[model samples]
Target: MTTHAPQTPGHPLPTGFPAGTMILTRRGLVPIEEVIAGDDVFTHQRLWRPVTAAMRTTAPTVRVHCASLASGLAATADRPFLTRVARVFLEGGEAGELSSAGWTRARDLAEGHRLASPLDFGKPVPVPDLPASLTGIDPADVLRTAGNMIRLKGEAAAALRPELVDWLAAQFGGYGARRRFPAWALTMPEELRTAFLDGLVNDGPQRDQFAVRMHSKSFMVGLRLLVCSLGFAGGLSSQGRPGKPGWLLSWKREGGRRPDHDGFRWHPVTRVEHGPEAEVFSLSVAEDESYIADGIAVRNRTERLTSL
Candidate 1:
């Protein structure tokens, strides 16, 4: 009697496949956003490509990844056409032919973040020889309020409140509780509290025989969407394989740069300010109609040349 070998089973492999997908997060392990975005993030690029391709094709994935820094995902995973368009990123697909352009935009944003203050994500990226600081506050602090400052001010997300920063630090500190994801619960089922507690310490029961599986199956992938071609998502550099390095922008800073006009604040590098009354000091700009009209003439006579 010809009998096929009995299928070895756990989470039984789909026969003819159930149109499955493979996911990877933390490239396997998971951690905080800043840590993941640190200098050594590129350590696992080859592995992520296949995983990202799975995201494009699979039903969905919910994952936490500092590499991209966002979570909780749905909806976009089923975009049938997206798979067709992004086939090049997937395995058994076409990662080889796309050329550098496929990843150019992502890499550029990665570089920009790196250019900002390496110590703090809050600072702006300085421009060469331009007088001014990129940012005056910590990026972790500023990130919270960045959105609120613009559109959702006064909401929970706005970084304006100091409490938020503290809370973030507590959750990511490694031993504290994370009300949101609760690291303890991931290892065992959420329903059991004692088991989670028993495993909470370093290399405790929580680290083995229980830690929930880690993955980039969905959430971190969603971050990729938000950051697409938009520059860094207002955060730190993403350590990815061959991911570009951060940068710094600096230029000369002389006094009397900022200026005010018609109730508007014009930047200092571009303008100079003069005060009103007696007249109070105000900002002014170095506008040269002549230069605009005739670039060749200015280039020929300028005593100092600088790159803007």
Candidate 2:
């Protein structure tokens, strides 16, 4: 039987939605499972609340094959594939207006279909265009770490050790001619950088050789560390290299250990196999440990788990 770790006192699992399960409500796009009957869902640039909720059997179930064209292009060119995903759907009432709306899949969502947009004084607003490419780092961590440093008083921020900052900067700043620095690392103020790195080093077991190695150099590595630090499992993958170099970072989940104790663990994906279905993959961590993503598995390994 699988056992779950006891909840930590001060820390909680990060909030997120399962793959392929988000709904557009007055608050913007949220996981459909998270929606309540009274919550306002977006329809025709207006808010509509559900009166009754029921699950009924239907003749044909909808499925979408939403592909990141960019990632597809990169896969063809033999580069890292970074397409991430989450589930989204329209409620029954919202679907009535569309011609091919019933059981419509994400790939089928087209122009004229209204989705819940972020609100400005209860009025739906247009969604903004996002950058075609992202740096593969979680934006939340960057904002939180920066905010923490900014909140520190003059002496506290300035008192950080110089050597620590230099070491961190070197690791994230890149080592050779072809290397590129993380955008956050390049833009962060000197004092903030010092404080951020110092917090991670001092928060937990810095003596662990594996931990040191995992947290060193790569901004992506540090981002994984940050995700694990926040008490969630993080999966990393790259194109061409399936498992050897990919990292699975997570805190201890089953042991009865102190929550504050930073027991970060790292594993390499030894193997990756295509699932019986399309857009699905199974990852092997060890002889006895494996997890399925985007498959029939009820529980997923990671929120952003994707094929490489």
Candidate 3:
């Protein structure tokens, strides 16, 4: 699996994202425009489903920002987003508690409405043998590259060694700027996944569960996808407001139990605004009509609607 940018491709009518919307696919985060029929994608069910169709659209979109959602989600107003309201008995007040979850439209979402944020772990993909080590790369070259990776010291330095760093760099460039998981690492064996996550945890404050903060948006985003891909509930939170720097990446330990609310956390909607009308994309999935987008459960439109 690898991340991709927008490109033309062939499918129908559903509320969709503009160009550059990164979708979680079997081949990693691929642009919706680039997605084609038969591409397997991760769904809210924590299972893989093949894409039945793809569609290009231009619609008026609503930009929805949740309390914990970084960058938010942009989709047509009628697009269904898995949401739930707090089970508050009081008059007109949002509470910490929640009620049964249901699908809600992006335009209908209001302040304090809770959206289902995916933290559920996924089914593991088996990898039998590990890749052979490189023979010609210089140790000094690797070390020099390591200097540009996440800073490590003491025992921590060993995890980001020349071999590992070199290997990762060669596969997924953007070492210090935009960290990404190499395709091999994304579907690595269970043992290697454990070691890889542990190494990442070592790069940050690890008092309770594994939690780390990084300034690189792409890197943190990639890490979030990596953890989620490995069947672990991963959460990415921006330290400041949108467009601001810094992101906190946290996840349950590999062997730990699943997250509460069936591996989903309630993300309160913070804002909803009228966004510009732009080109969007949508996909039709086989059986499960819903797919995970930016950590939230979003369903594609079964029937097309007129412009909002």
Candidate 4:
């Protein structure tokens, strides 16, 4: 007779499988199952390769406090609304092989947690004097819109909106809702804010001037969303492992009022990729030339691209 290890309720292979596992790799936190022997895992200042390893024991399950996890998650500047538990990979000190330190829910990661730093192959990288900034745009608008889009997909995803709203409220407080403007928008220079509003309501050279400035802000915001969505989708696709290919995803904004010629509006475009293997999926959003150009640039530079 053959004997097998006891499996977790929702996972395959009972005790030994690395399902929902995350490991600190050179790229970032990747699933332990996805890790290859030569992959570089992180330590404080050194990189180590995981050659061979096995799970020896399983810890007794403990009741995790949901409120604690939620509060800890709230502190994150970019807290994801959805989450799940996964096995995390951590460095085993000076040891070369990676270890499945324990199982942790992604939402439960707290402030003091450390991740392996990515290895740069002995190159002198230039450190910029000033940090990059995404200024003058209201992130709440983007987040709210994104949340709504997810929510409208129906009950299967109904929880997303409230989660995002609660997280935003925690981060920015009631001020934004009370003022009816995004926190960042409220902080804009008086002249710039007035100009932006005027550009929305009026036309002519003055509107054009303000529109140009406002559009610059919009472009930055859109670019940020585009980049973030791509990363989020790619990461969610199991780091593009074989048989688990990743996708390049994007969103479009559509059917909104256009205030001025250069006013930010979402435009729609359809693309078909012809290849030996192809699949069709669709999503809608609005756009302008700047966003279109940026989208093109992103697609040109990426693989397996898809838009929503």
Clashes of each: 51, 5, 4, 17
TM values, all candidates: 0.16, 0.22, 0.67, 0.20
Off by over 4 Å in 4: 1-18, 46-48, 56-58, 63-308
Error of 2 at 154 (Å): 17
lDDT by residue (tens digit), candidate 1, 56-128: 1112221111212211111111111000011122322123222221111111122111100011111122211
lDDT of 3 by residue, 5-103 (tens): 232443233577776555667655555677788888777777789987776667789988875455677888988988877634232222446667778
Error of 2 at 201 (Å): 25
Off by over 4 Å in 1: 1-79, 82-141, 144-162, 165-219, 229-308
lDDT, candidate 4, 209-257, per-residue tens: 2111111212222222222222111101111345443222222122212
Each model's lDDT comes to 0.19, 0.26, 0.61, 0.24
* Model 2 agreement with the true structure over 1-308: per-residue lDDT tens digits: 21212223444221122222333333333333344444454332223344122111111122312111111100011111111121222322122222321211222333332211111113323322222332364544443343233224234633543222333333333222212223233224434343454443444324321121131113333343333333333233322234323222333222322111112121211222221211211111212111111210111123322210
| Candidate order, lDDT descending | 3, 2, 4, 1
- Give candidate 1's root-mean-square deviation (CA, Å): 27.0
Worst 10 residues of 4 by lDDT: 295-304
How well does model 4 score by local distance difference test?
0.24
lDDT of 1 at 53: 8
Weakest 10 consecutive residues, lDDT, candidate 3? 2-11
